[model samples]
Target: MPFQHPETTGHGYVIERYVTRKDSDHPRYLELNGAHVLRPGWPHAKRFARHLIDDATTITDAELEALLAYEWRSRLTAAWLIGVDRRESFRERIGDLLLASEVCYSGGGFCFALARFGTHADAEILTAYLDHYLPRTDLHYDQPDALGALLHLDARLGTHHADRITEPDGLWDEWVKGVGRLGHPSHTPAELRRWTDLHCDFINDWSRS
Candidate 1:
């Protein structure tokens, strides 16, 4: 089933499941400048991110944007993999995607990913979603990811988000340093705010009730 953004009448993406093992976590070649040389159909999203991080300085913006269409995970992965080097491309291209998406897991992922990977300008991009959901009654049921995105963005960009976030302090504290266990801070789910390694005081009370 293809799910779309509620706000967008006909905009959405599909999560493709890989049937066979093909792409490897390690790239075929690693450049001296941390640039990862990737072939056309590499399967692993982590490998792609590793490549991006490795080649943060050398990879071209066009090359990074091109990877956005590679797969679902990679698309989001690419958003975070994008470093401060070619921020304009990420702001332009990824910003377009984020603005087009409605409030959902994918949106939150994009929200968190970009906010974490993005720079000062990203604060503007993230607050819209954060403020949008923070006021909703359903926030108790959903929106930890969005909240976390704000915290991550604030922490990273030094933006004063503490005033904007009206949610309980306990909820905000759930977002710890180092992006939690959901991989990079950008990769964390918009709905989940707990850490896998550390003991946290968060449970989906809405679900339990």
Candidate 2:
């Protein structure tokens, strides 16, 4: 049965109310919510996934693999939920997700969510991804959304070398602005000032062009 949000009132009220029920013994309670519903297609999957995670039910390895195949948005939500589990299964799946691509919202969210774990292996994996995939100035790097993902991961992973990543007179400035929205440490006052200065210079040069 699909889990419903707690605040929902109607035919689904039973499902909705059960979501927040504090009783862990309930047979229907799941450990991980089905985030697939709240995603673009279902719009209720997120609540389901949350309910499942909160319930503490065991998530099988096969189920985890199926989740990884979802689209970026759903995958990101799944990753965040999986990180909450703190299981070896979750860690392995998340590692796979990181290598797949540079998903903006999900990748960024996953990085931030997993940051609290602070495991050495996880850190090494994220750092390696940045080292291999982030240094180039291609469409992936130039994309503001993608840049936001990179910056979020960088902040959580404490990645340095902002100088190497920024393009002198291109969309790098805009990317920084997008990163600012993530509320990561990279958007600190000093960092913001640095980005602002670079952005101003880039805009000035653009006007002259």
Candidate 3:
């Protein structure tokens, strides 16, 4: 029998289970640049991240392209791998995918990759994403992740690229209200940290409960 795409099953656990595999950690890639600390599955996530970064030279561009062509999980993993490796040649391709926003879940990976690139061009791509999507409050697609990426870039580059969107009553504010209506309002530091790392707190709480 042939392997099936996890998303096709329409079962979230099936998808989450797929996350533990070596090649793809969709939705979260274990922040390569994150501050080192302990958390649930931190050892597991960190190990995979280190492996990807360590073996970056061995991963061929052809392999990454194939990953990008597959489902969101593969695309997510590809983005992190590309970013960590500093594969400048793939930057445009990643940026295009980020702008397309064709699929769900993988956008976070794209954002992380672009942020890793840490170039003004990468920041522009992130800005363009927020410009186009933040106003579409009903869609709720990766706006926060893009914004987070932009802010991360700004801090690194000493640029204020994210200032306009974050102002009171600006696009970010509008998005917050919309998200709040759906009971998903928080974007605090702790909440934002989950975007980069495995949600260890969530996992611990879930397992205990």
Best by lDDT: 3
Candidate 3 — which residues are off by over 4 angstroms? Answer: 1-20, 23-41, 188-209
Tens-place lDDT per residue, model 1, 1-209, is 24332224321221211111123433222221122322233344345334334554554555455545444444544454453233555666665566555323334435545544546666666666555544443333124545555555565566776443544443233433223443433333333322211101111111122
Point out where model 2 deviates above 4 Å.
Answer: 1-58, 102-104, 139-209
lDDT of 2 by residue, 139-185 (tens): 24213322333444455457643344464533354444544455522
Highest TM-score: give the candidate number.
Answer: 3
Q: Candidate 3, residues 1-209: lDDT per residue as tens digits?
A: 23245344433332232233444333333332233323444455445544555545566776666567666776776776676666889878987888888777778778877877779998899888889888877777788778777877787788988889888888888888887787776595334535533322222333334
Candidates ranked by TM-score? 3, 1, 2
TM-scores, all models, native as reference: 0.45, 0.44, 0.72
What number of clashing residue pairs does each candidate have, in the order they appear? 5, 21, 0
Task: List lDDT for all candidates, in order.
Answer: 0.41, 0.43, 0.65
